[model samples]
Target: MSTFGQYFRVTTFGESHCKAVGCIVDGCPPGLELTEGDVQPQLTRRRPGQSNLTTPRNEKDQVVIQSGTEFGVTLGTPIGLFVANQDQRPHDYSETDFYPRPSHADWTYLQKYGVKASSGGGRSSARETIGRVAAGAIAEKYLRLVYGVEIVAFVSSVGCVEMPFIAQMRNDRALEPEFFQLLDSITRERVDADMVRCPDKDVADQMRDEILKNKEACDSVGGTVTCVIRRVPSGLGEPCFDKLEAKLAHAMLSIPATKGFEIGSGFAGTAMHGSVHNDPFVNSTVDPQGKPNLRTATNFSGGIQGGISNGEHVYFRVAFKPPATISQAQTTAQYNGQGGILAARGRHDPCVVPRAVPIVESMAALVVMDAVLAQNSRSKSASLLPAVSKSNPLMYGQPPSS
Candidate 1:
């Protein structure tokens, strides 16, 4: 689908190498503060040429708010956002015209549309995500302002260079309270501290070296990104198909090159018994508002149960495949049904997980923001109901007593 979300609909447009790329965001609440500055941080993080590990293409990816805001506040109308493509190198993609890159959308896109963009895989390019990041920025700002939600993502693994704790946590099928605390304290500043974007300095260095090795070999690598959403209120997401995790998976898998999505224990939970996987809830002290809070002794469920948020941290990991285009020579079939050697040429990232951090965070924000809006609409309707009382005949669809 070109558009995403029910309450907070976003329809992105343009493509890689196009004159511009952006989106139209609808259903944004009014009277909230918004500006280009609020959206630029994520775009800058997702932009190319940030480091030697990423693509050398230098795109400032500056966003312009064309409509839907006045005096720095949203007008609750459709928001028009745009970012011009300033670094397009269409000639570099001429090689792909005759033969499709292996494991790329070139073959499938040609089959689906009977036509394809002449350069840079068009919508298949990572550059297409610029619109997503921009729209997500607005969603994120609103989420943070209204619910104090914090979303952070980091490169958890690049090829075999995984975080030290990842294997252990998978084996144990448990997450420590300390880990939650650490996740709570994590900021984009920390995630962006190094080029690899892994919070652990040692692991990040190892990941960097791995990517450099792949780049040197004219190859590419794939990895996973772990994201945590904290301070999300309970009761988001519908019951069946539109469940929170389901919607999250939909949003995540929609991103280019994303191969898998897992929440909480994810695939690891299957190895353990229900006794180990089930989260045991315990009563907790009240919040500042004097409302009692319930917390689990263990978060094996990953802050979600039955596909819904439980007033705990909602976290997930997205698996990304290696960039399909590599300079390495590969023997593949041509459009004429003949065999030939193809060596992709064009600037590409050796490993995409580092840049994918912000994209993951941005998609998560859109999902959560959409859910929040849906819940708000439902809550508003429910709030108008009169209290159940025998004296009130209107409760039974009759006239009230005079």
Candidate 2:
């Protein structure tokens, strides 16, 4: 299933170390404004070697638009986008081609495909996410313009370093642009500042010092990313299948090295009773001049009820496993099925949480965009159904004249 979506479809192609990786998006509405600039910022955020917290693989990751747009506007056709790979070091991987890295996809890929690309985990590499991020950028633009929906994600936890809860941050007024700027400035002062993207100055400093120590020892750690969505309209998902949360979890888990996912009140909800867990409704208002609004007094349901959006903030967290390519020596087997031990080499991250923030946000955008398109189709279908039924008559108890 390289293809995804029932309405706005996206088909990804190419491999991690192939000539290039790219995507073709079908079903994009025509006349939408788009350009390379729109997608570049996101790709830059996910590109490796940006700082000390990720693999030292430096890729320019410049995007090329091949088709489906003209004069900076979409043409209602399949949009083709690509990114060429530069700075590939096939030699770095030649030695380990025979010995699969522990906790990586090497063994599973071989069992399924008989043969696999020997360099850089081939299709299994996080490099494949370039295409996804590019496609997701376009989807995000559409979502914002049509729905005023906004998605923001950040590294909330790295191993033991956790950012304060949103409530606490808000209460502290830490979200002020100037306050956040000062926090960002302080982080930039450290050599390994990006090891964890936590906004707390003190916690970030501690995280950086710890990461540097681990880097010196050639070890790695894993952590989680929290994504928040605001102003999402109601009725955004299909029932029985393709629930909003289900689609989000599926997209997120597809990312390389992602091991777990939870939507709003996940896992922790087990501690509460039914009454405490439920999102109780309350009388609310939408527009000042319009009718009263609907809302939940508590968001235990995470802005979603019965697999459909209930007009609350939709948020979730995704957990990533430690990068398998640690410098520490480990037990493994040779390609010839001979058992042996090997130490992995190459430029790898001590922690991936900082870099993973953008990837999580991209996947979240992809899921939300698909759900929005599905909702649009359903609305159009319902609008026409009544007229069609009245005209055909056979659609109801009335039959055509004999």
Candidate 3:
């Protein structure tokens, strides 16, 4: 259950209060130059104590490379990474002994394992994502160097405040022009410049203040993160089962507190007629052989059509529920069906969207990376066969009869 991806496989380990938390990344191509420097910055961004909007848990989240590299180059073997749990405070969670803590993982984990971790949320904690972030950085490095892929995610909303796309989403599902431009030109540097990690400076400030307000009230709030992957090549997905958007949804929803997942025109496009919802093609690309390529007139498909990438910017949004471990008192049931008021004690984010930004981006990289490897395998194998001629009924290039 711990492992993910078919080709670019990764297995994560460790609990919230464990000695260390990390992952083993398998199947990375050899000779790719990698080091702690390539991975640490994202871990640092995912770390706690970043700002007033997050938990006060002062973890530096320092990462170390344990194996699978020789002189800072990946050897195409399993890469082991670990980050010390230096600032963990398990005692703070003692209140969970009496009650399961509503909306928290305490009750279900105990039911599932017949036992639970001694402290914190155990494997249920967001801390478990350190391994994901680490593995993703490696995948990102490969994608970046070889394919020029760029993934950028930002806090699109915090509680009621939303980025313009979400704010004005209508049944027609035609998002704003500015939203498209934002996807075309946004950068991580611009995203990180804001206090709340939202690229729009004005929205970031308001989101920050709102989170501080929730923090002061000992409550938690929910929000969403939007991610865009650019320069991903066409035909990178499995059909019928692992559609590109389906895999993206699975990966994004796997994060600790994710509540929902939607890709380009999601939900909002449902009300539109096919005439408005369909993406029309335009001849806008040229191959190295000087052949023209078909491009989408509108990206309503979100860079994917028929379960494959369409060589356009792939964009999606993930919604995170409020951090379940709030310090506020609440009436809830105990493990024995007894009822009582519980005031939980733990360090959790008032708003998770800012920190979830990197997690979203990393998971996107992993999905795209896995898809790349799968497609590459197929392409290589197909190259060995004779090309299909127009006379063949099974020709892949032939469109279906109307």
Model 1, C-alpha of 162: deviation from truth (Å) = 0.4
In model 3, where is the ten-residue run with the lowest total lDDT? 390-399
lDDT of all predictions, in order shown? 0.90, 0.77, 0.90
Best by TM-score: 3
- Candidate 3 at residue 125, lDDT? 92
Candidate 3 lDDT, 168-239, residue by residue in tens: 775335787888999999999999897599998788888888898999999999999999999999989999
Instruction: Give each model's clash number.
Output: 0, 2, 0
Residue range 139-254, candidate 1, lDDT tens digits: 99999998999999999999999986578677775666666676778888998889899999999989999999999999999999999999998989888889999999999999
* Greater-TM-score candidate between 1 and 3: 3
Estimated TM-score for each candidate: 0.94, 0.86, 0.96
Q: How many backbone clashes are present in model 3?
A: 0
Instruction: For candidate 2, write residues 1-402 as lDDT tens digits.
Output: 677676778888877667888789898889999999999888887788987767888888999889999999999999999999887777777767779888888888888989888787888888888888888889889988988877776666666666665334335422334423332233212312444666566767776766667777888877777777777889888887888988888899988888998776677666566876787779866566343468886675667888999988887878888778888878777878798887776667788777777777777888888888788888888977645534565644356887
* Per-residue lDDT of 386 in model 1: 75
Ten contiguous residues minimizing lDDT sum, candidate 2: 183-192
Which is superior by lDDT, 2 or 3? Answer: 3
At residue 31, what lDDT does model 3 achieve? 98
